[model samples]
Target chain A: MQPTDLTPHAEPELIVFRDVSVHFPVFNASTRSFRKRVIQVATGGIVAPDHTGHIVVQALTNLNFGIRSGERVALFGHNGAGKTTLLGALSRIYAPTSGSAEISGAVGSLINISLGTDPESTGRENIFLRAAILGLGRDFIQKNLEEIIEFSELGDFIDLPVRTYSSGMQLRLAFAVSTMLRPEILVMDEWLSVGDKNFQSKAAARLDAMLRDTKILVLATHSRDLALRHCNRALWLEHGRIKLDGPVKDVAAAYFGK
Target chain B: MLENLKAAMADIARSRHYASLIHILGWQDMRHRYRRSFLGPFWLVASTAALVATICLILGPMFGLPPEQYVPYVAAGMIVWGLIVSMCTDSCQAFISQSTMIRQTAAPLFTYVARVAWRNTLLFAHNLVIFPVALWISGAHSNMNALLAVPGFLLVLANLAWIGLVLAILSARYRDLPKTIDSVIPVLMFMTPIMWKPEMMPLRIGVKILQFNPFYWMIDLVRVPMMGGIPPGKVWVGAAVVALVGWVVALILFARTRERIVYWL
Candidate 1:
C-alpha cells in the first residue's frame, strides 16, 4: 500500500477528538488471581457489574475538541480532573474508550520531562538516551548534540555523571534535550522554570524560542497567569468532563469566577 | 477494541522510528550492564565455561566417554541451551521493564521487546566462544558441514525474536508468567539433552521427550554442526514450522493486546 496518507503537509496538524471517553477497568478481586479467573472463565464467562469485578474508571467522558495548527491551548483542572487524560489521548498514549482521537503530526512530549534519563550516566549519555526516547533519530541527535550541550550551558558538568548534578542542573539538561527537537505538536504539563535565577532566564528564553514555530502547543497547567500568557485557547476539565472550552479570557473568567 | 488492536499492530509495524531506539537501547544495555566489570561481557564466557566444566566432571565418567569428546558435546549443548532458556525467561520482561518509557512516550511495544532480544543476542555471541575451542579440544576438524551451524544459529535468533515478542505481551499482563517460566526453564533444561546424551536413554523415552521439546531441534541445528556432524533434515523442518507458526500466533496476539499492555504495567 502507498504510504498511508496522514494529515497533509503545509497545513496545521488537525487534532480532532470526537466524543472520546477513556475507561480504565480497575483490575479487582476476581481478576487478580489465576485460580479465581480460571473458575470464572470455565463457567462460560465473567459476570459482574460492567463485566465482572472491573470497576471502570471513567477517565474521560465524551471528550470532544478540535485543535488546529497555530492554536495554543491550555488545559486547567484540579487534581483528579481529566487534563492529563485528555493530553494522554492527544499523545495517543491512551486510546479512547469510545469515539475517536485523531491527530496528524509528529508529537513531541515533555511529560515527566526527564522520564527515561539515566542518572548513573554522564550528562552527555543521558542526553542521548532521552533523545532516543523522544523519538529523535541518532543522526539528528549527533548533528545537534553540541548545540544541545551548549544550550543547556552544562559546560564541564556534561562530562560528569548526572547522578552528581543537582536537581536544577539535571532539569536544565532535560529541558535542553527536550526542546532541541522542533516537533509539529508541542505538549507540556506546565510552564517550566529551572536552575538558579541566572540560568532560569536563559531557560525561559529557550522555551519561548522553542514555542515560536510549534504548529500546536498544548500546555496542561494550574497557573492562570501561565495559561493567559502562553495559550490563546483554554479547556477546563472537571471530573473527567469538559467544564468549558473557549477563548482564554472567557474560559478563564468563567472557571475562576467564584 | 479491534481498532485499538489495529492501531497497536500498526504502531508495532512502524519500525522506521523504533529500530534506531531498539538498537541503541540494546547496545547501551549491554554496555551498561558490564561497565564496571573488567572482563565485561567476557564474563558470560567464563561462567558458561565453569558450568560446562562442573557438569563434565560429574557426568563424564557416568557416560563412559573420554573427557575430550564429552566436554565439547556438553559445552556446546549448554551454550545453545543457555541462550534459548535466557530468551524464554527474558522475553517476559520486554515491555514490563520499560513501563516508564511506554507511559511517557509513544514508542511501539516491540521496541522494548527488541531491546531484550538484542541484549541477549550480544550475550549469546559471547557465549559462542566455546564452540570452536570445544571443536579443537575434542580433536575435531573444521569441515564444510561445520559452516551449517552458522545458518542454524541464525535460525535460532529468528525464532528468538518472535518468541520474545509473544512472551513480552503475555508476561506483561500476567504477573505469574515470568516466575512460572523461571521455574519451568531449569526443568526444561533437564528435559532437553544438555549434559546427558539421547543415546544413553531408552529409544522410546528419549524420542518421547525430544518430540515434545522444540529446543532439541533448535539446539541440534547448532549443536550437531558444531561437532562436525550434519543436523538431520527433520530438525530443520521442525525449526521452520516452529518459526512460522510462532510468528503467526505472536502477530495476532500482538495486534490484539498491544494497547492493553500499558494498563497492565
Candidate 2:
C-alpha cells in the first residue's frame, strides 16, 4: 500500500497493520476453575505437552493493511468474519498476539456509544461520564456541554435521571455525547442510526461535519449502500482473513455478488 | 518478559493522567450505591460508628479491658480493618465489574484498579470519622504521635493498591479466585488481632503467627499510629517490604496477563 492514493497529507499513514493476528485463548469452565487447575498441578495430570492443549480461537490472522489520512475504509464480512475484531484491534481494545499494529492518532469508537452511561445518573452527568470514558478531558466536555445538549434536543430533560427518559430520549443523550469526540481516527461498528427520522437527519448532518474533520475513518458494517456511499476503500474479510482489498465499488460488487 | 514489564509500568504511570476520569467514576460508584438513601455516604459512617460502639460496649468487657483502654484500640482496628477487607474483596471484581468498559475502551488496566483503590479510600475516610468519636468517648488522649497515621495510612494504601491490582488481574482470568478470596478474608479477620488485643493470645503460637501475618503488620502500620503509638521499626520494615515485593509480583502478573484480560472476559 502506497501513500499516493489520497490527498497531499503531511502524515504518511494513520493506521498500519503488518501481519497482525489476534488469538483468544478460550478458558472454559474447566480451564478457568482454580480447583481443577490446582488438582492438575498436584496430581501431575492433564499436563498437555504445550499450549496446543488449550482452546484458542483465531479471531484475526495475518491482516496486512494500511489506512492513510483522508481515506474512508469499510470492513465487510460475514457475522464471524473478523470485521469487528479488526476494528477492535484498530481502536486498541485487542492487542495483536503476533506481528504489529501501530495507530498514531486518538481513536474515537462509536462501537458502543452508551458505553459508560449510567442509568441512575442524570443525563448531564452521563454526558460527562461517557465523554470521560472516551478519554476526553474535562475542559473539552465542559466547553461543549451546551452545544451537545442543544444538538441532542434534550433541553430541560438533561437534568433528569437517564432512567426516567424514554429509550429514544436516552439514545439522543448518548448520541449527543458521542458526537462530541473530535478524534483524528474515527471508528464505527455500524453507521449509528440514532433516534427518530427527524433526529436521524440531524444526526447525519452532525456526523458528516464530524467526518469532515476526521483524518481517517474505519467503519465495519453490512450495509453495501452505506459502504459504497461513504467509503472510498473496502476490505472483504472471510473467516478472519482479508479476502479482497480495493476500491469500495469493486470490492462490494465482488463480495456482495455482481 | 522485560518488554511486558515495561508496558505494565507504563500502564501504571499513564493511569495517573486519567485521575479526573477515575475520580469521577469512583465518586459515581459511591453515589450509585447510596443514591436513594437519605444519609448517602453517611450511611457508611453510621454503620461503622454502630459497629465500633457495639464492640466497645460488648467486646470491651468480654475481653476484660476497660473502655478507656479498649475503645480506641478496637475502633482504630475496626476502621483500618474495614479498609483492608473491602479493598481486597472489592478489587476482586474491579475488572469483572468493568468488563464492558474494558472490552470496549483501551483505557489503562490500572485505571480500573485505581478506581477500586480510590473508592475504598473514600470509604476509609468515612470510617476514619469513627476513630475521633471513639477517642472522645473513651477519654483517651492522642498526642502528636497520631500525626504519624498520615504517612502510615499512605503506606497502607500503597500496599493495598498492589494487592488489589494482583487480585483484580488474577480473578479476572481465574473465575474462582474471587470466591476463594471471599472465604479466606473472614478467616483472616479471626486470625488477625482486630476485635481483641494481642495480649489475649497465648504467646508461643500467637506471636509467631502474627509475626508472619502480613495483615497484622498492615493493620499495625495504621492502627498503632491512630491510637497514638509508633509502630515498631520491624512493622514498618515488614509493611514496606510487602509493598515493594507485592508490587513487583503484581507488575509481573499484570504484564503477563494484561493483554489477555479482555479475552478472559
Candidate 3:
C-alpha cells in the first residue's frame, strides 16, 4: 500500500493517539490484606497509591493528537505535564490505558540512547548490542560497524569499554548508533543536549540528517527556541491534555506566554 | 496467533546472538560486583570452592556417602543451582535494575532479562571449572560419559529461559517478587535433591513428595551424566516436557505483560 493511503483522512498521520486516558489504581499502604484492597477499590480507593495524598498521579489524562506524515511536531510542556508520557505513548513504551495509538510506520525513539551499552564492553560490541535492541539485524550492524565507529570519533577507544570514555564520548557513540538508520517516525526527548559543545554541533548535524528522511518527528522539550527552530507544528501538553496545538511559533508563544 | 508465534520464532532465530548480548552485559555485572575487591572474579571461584568443601565435610559423612563422590556432586549441583537461582532473582529485578534505561529508551525489555540470564550463565561456567578440579583432587572416578551431560546442560538452559521470561515480567509489575524469590529459593533448595540423593528419603511419602519436585528431575538429569549412569527415561521425558510447557507459558506471559512492565515499574 502506498504511504499516502495509510491514513487516508489525515494524509497518513505517522502517529495518532485517540482520546487516551491512563489511570493507575492507588492502594492504601496500611492495609496490606487482599480484602482491604478489594474494599478500597470498591469504595473508590486508589489501586496503587503514591506518596502524595492523591491516590494516583494522573500521568496523562485524555490526550488526543495526531502528527501528519513529514510533520515535525514539538511536544512542549512543564515537568510532569505529560510531554514525556505522550512521547512514550508514541514510541510504544507506554500503552494508553483507555485509548488506542496507531502508527503508520516504523518508529525509532531516542528516549534513552545508550539503553544497552556495557561499561566493560568495547564500543564496537556495544554498537552491535544497541543496534540489535533497536531492531536492526546483526548483519546490518556488521555492515555499518566501521561507519558507526567513525561517526562516534572514538577511534582507538572503539576497542575499549564505554566506562573509560567521557560522557560526551558515550553520547556521541550512542547518538551515532541510534541515527545510523533512518526511521519513519523519530521520537526524541531532550537527548539533543549532549554535554560536549563540539559534539553538540555534530549531534545537531546528525539530527538534521535524520530529520530529512524522517516522515514524522515528535520532539518533547521545554526549550521554546528549539521547538520553534526545529518543528513546524507544536503541541502544548498541560496536565496530560493538549492545551494548545498550532503553528510552532504560535504554540511556543502561548506555552511560554511571551 | 500462530503467525505471531512463527514471527516470534523467526525473530528469535534472527536474533539468536541477542542471547550473547547478555554475556557482554554479564561481564559488566561481574566487574561491577568485584569493582574494588582485590581478588575480583577469582573471588567467585574461591568462595564457591570454600562452600563446597564445607558442605562435603559436613554432609558427606552425615548422609553415609563418600566424600570423593559427594564433593563433586554437591559442587556441580551448587554451580547449576546458583545459575538458576541468580537468573530467577536477578530477572525479577531486571526492569527495576535498569529503571533509568527503561524510562529513557525504547529498547525491548527482554534485553535486560537476557543480560541477567547471560551474566548468571557465565558465572555458572566459571563455577563449573571447580567441579572437574574438585573431582580430580578428591580422586573420584572421572567417567568419559560425563560428556553426555551436554544434553542435560542444554535442558537447564532452556529451563532458565522460561523462568527468566516469566519472572522478568512478573517482577517488573510486582515490586515484591524479588524479595519473595529471595526468601523462597533456599526453601526450594532444601526441598529439591541437590545435596542429597532422592533415594535417601526415609519415608515413602517423602520420596513421593521429592519426586513431585521438578527440580529433582533436573538435578537427576544432569547428575546422571556426571555420575556416570543413564538417567531414567522418565526423568528426561519429564524434564523436557516441563521445560517445554514452562517455556510456552512463559513466552505467552512475557508477550502479554511486557507492554505493561514499564508502567508497573
| Model 1, runs deviating above 4 Å | A1-13, A43-51, B1-9
Q: Which residue segments of model 2 deviate by more than 4 Å? A: A1-11, A42-46, A49-53
Tens-place lDDT per residue, model 2, B83-178, is: 999999999999998888898888898999999999989988888888888889899878888899988889999999999999998898889999
Residue B111 C-alpha lDDT in model 2 = 97
How well is each residue in A65-135 modelled by candidate 3, as lDDT tens digits? 77788688898888888877777778776777788878778788877787867777778888877876676
Q: Tell me the TM-score of each prediction against the true structure.
A: 0.92, 0.94, 0.85
- Docking level for model 2: medium
Across A214-235, the per-residue lDDT of candidate 1 in tens digits comes to 8899999988898899988999
**Candidate 2 chain B TM?**
0.97
lDDT of 2 by residue, A28-128 (tens): 68888988878888987667735525688999999998888888999999999998888889988899999899999899888888788788988998888
Q: Specify the highest-TM-score model's number.
A: 2
Q: Which residue pairs does candidate 2 place in steric collision?
A: none
Which wins on lDDT, candidate 1 or candidate 3? 1
Candidate 2, residue B13: the lDDT equals 93
Docking class of 3: acceptable
lDDT of each: 0.82, 0.88, 0.77
Tens-digit per-residue lDDT, B1-265, candidate 1: 5675676567767755767777777877887778889999888789898898788888888778887678888888999898898888888888788887787788877788777877888888899898777767666555677789889998898898898998888877676778878988988888888888777777776677677688877888988887779988878888888898988788888878876777777
Query: If the candidates were sorted by their lDDT against the true structure, best first, what order would they fall in?
Result: 2, 1, 3
What is the TM-score of candidate 2?
A: 0.94
